[model samples]
Target: MLKQKSGPSRRKVILIGLDSAPPELLLERFLDKMPTIRRLVKNGISGRMRSCDPPITVPAWMVMMTGMDPGQLGIYGFRNRKGWSYSDYYLTTSTMIKEKPIWEIIAQTAGMKSCLIGVPPSYPVRPIMGNLISCFLTPGLEKEYTYPHELRDEVAEIVGEYEFDAAFRSDNRDEILEAIRRMTNKRFDLANYMIEQKEWSFFMLVEIGLDRLHHTFWKYFDDTHPRFESGNRFEMVLEDYYILLDKRIGELIENCGEDTIIIIASDHGSKAMKGAFCINEWLIREGYLKLAERPEGIVSIEDASVDWDKTKAWGWGGYYSRIFFNVKGREDKGILTKEPGGDLDELVTELKEKITRLVDNRGVPMKNTVFSPDELYKTVRGDPPDLMVYLDDLNWRAAGTIGHGKIYLEENDTGPDDSVHSMDGVFILYDPRERIRKDIGTMSIMDAAPTILRRIGLSIPKEMIGKPV
Candidate 1:
């Protein structure tokens, strides 16, 4: 167990997690429109917070809360390999997280109560010292979503059948827009109610609507998007949503009172997606992955008949690519050996070189980055991919489907996504008692937990890698 010390003073902390909020949009472009956020930045310390590698939501949010990197957490993405098996995998849940989060730590050390809402992988709600509500990852309302069980009834009374997530990937923009608004409004309503009704020293709520908005309506507002056009029907949609968000934030702050410490943060940033790179197709063409028979149309790699005996590697796709090597003694029908100066090592080297030097559709060099799990994290814990790839610095998502007959695609393979997650998210920390309008510049996402712990009069855990800001 980690040791803790008591301090002379303790203050309430409110963490507003805005999923996929970028520094460029929140801090620069839309700052003037969000009066609440603008005032927070003006009175507090703000900066570009660097998100974790593979910068996706599940691991990123957990990373921020636990003060651990993805590798240390053993969670690379939403779905992870169960073992070395070809197909066995599991969706991450609260049960998988062994590391203690800030709430649990504070509850144990300082005896502080917490009211948490919508923190990722918080489904299958676990017991805490105070109130809790599950995140968007919750399957449905039928399952218990609150820590105390009865808290679910209170939530339902305030917002009928709580909206966990919005289907923003749909082509029906109007429907999705309405769904996003409804979800955001209901969530904020619940948050305000929790603030007034619950007794707690720490409160954290993550809003997933901003991420949905970016992915669904990015092209309409961002002139730089490849598919962008002037005066699109949804051009003002994003701006309007941000303003609404600001209004809700204002209310949330009002409920917290003037002495509370406020923090606005994002797990990862967002950006206009350039395109999708058909990673499976590229691997097949490069002779790393072998298909027994050609897919007649675009099909998931899982559905295709892969000749494992002849396949050296294959890849799964998302905002980044997770490439796995079929190694001897590690996988069934394994071909490559893991010995030093052997086939596996040589193949990894070759793939990294070729992938980094890849060019885009226009034959222009893409600034791709590749990493091994050991290279990115202090401790490699989970069944990590053989190689993690970021195409064109994450502007281009990786498509896991095959039979496209080409490597480049103009849209996301799974849905109509318009934006990709970026590296630099936004963060603003405000203390009502102090008006330090300081620009802290860049901070790591890992720094958030320790910073909060330090500010709230708790000693930082020795295992935590980040220093308090």
Candidate 2:
């Protein structure tokens, strides 16, 4: 997707990602509140980006930064299922990534240094040009103080007394709040210190707070929920957070020299997903699947858990589900040659359509589309799941292509789950006309890297999925 161009690049680019930040929240509403973001938008080019197909965090981020598809990055969805294989959650730096990342390109070609703080799945740091301090969804962190012969005192000061490891998955709100405060403090300290110490070419920071809040509180903030929180519900909460988040961003930009370029982008927007669809269960009910042990009719899912060795596939977590084709060689005890077939594709398409056509428990039709690897992929190297299913505004889907059947529709989907991710990610750019930034349509989980590079005067790599903006 590289179209070579000649141009003057900014010496310094600061890309701040407000994870799951929706453009609506920032359009004149939270500008005063999110001073930093507001300032960046005002001083730079800004726009609303529509995320790619199956707009989950992992794939979406990959799309935004590298401009590559999920098929290329090998990051299919929230968790990937490989046939009778167990599903594994995706964290950025996980061994699952299959393509060239934007960081490598920036460091290798741009002749610039970067400071990346707390971008998800970036923890087990890989080869890169700058210092990377990572956390898992802002909850799990390795304090610089813990590093061998660490500068414990200095790192502590920079990270502040608070450190948030709050994940949307965590059931505890107290812990979540504490983690958020800590994470925010650490993000602030890290960005500030990095800018001061390093003549950084790009300083990229992503705020995971908004995303977390949406996941945990969407139910309390939406009209459908009897427990919807806040008198203003989700909309007002967004504004409040924007105002608070803005001040932090403002401070970061305040210290920057006029020559420095600051850009703000989100991996993808958020939407509410309350209904749950366990594709694996649906397959079993349809007789497409069989299990050795069904767990005495079901008390709780844990009680009814199937024999992983017996079932063809299963899925869980978040607003999506993965359907695995039980093929041999690919699975622990696979049955087929693991070849891709038209049958497999068609079956998935049918199931996906059925899932999309579903009405929520409240009887509302889901709105979304399914993307095969080719469809999800725009680049030669696509990072898509075996099959990708994008859901409606309030409904999302996940699937795994690890089975042998042409169509292994589940008899039951995971139970009716409440809440979904947010749809409000932000994008503010300086000189976005850069070849790297020109095609950026929407933000995703993967965009932070290359965008950071472009801001710092680095050219995106030919092999990488995304380029600098």
lDDT of 1 at 155: 94
Error of 2 at 260 (Å): 1.0
Error of 1 at 154 (Å): 1.0
Clashes of 2: 80
Q: Evaluated with lDDT, which candidate comes out highest?
A: 1
Q: lDDT, candidate 1, residue 175?
A: 95
> lDDT tens string, model 1, 1-469?
8533234498789999999999998999999999999999999999999999989998999999988999888999999987888777899998989999999999998888999999998988999999999999998999989989999899989999899999878899999999999999999999999999988899999999999999999999999999998987899999999999999999999999878999999999999999999999999999999999998887997888999999999999999999999999989889999999999999989999999999999999999999998999999997899899999999999999999999999999998999999999988999988988989999999999999998898899987878899
TM-scores vs. true structure, each candidate: 0.98, 0.75
**lDDT, candidate 2, 277-382, per-residue tens:** 5454556666545655554433322234445454444434345444455445565665434347744445565666765675544566667555556654654242
Question: What does the lDDT come to for candidate 1?
Answer: 0.93
Candidate 2 residues lying further than 4 Å off, grouped into runs, are 1-10, 81-102, 137-153, 160-164, 167-175, 222-238, 296-317, 328-346, 349-353, 378-385, 394-418, 422-424, 431-460, 464-469
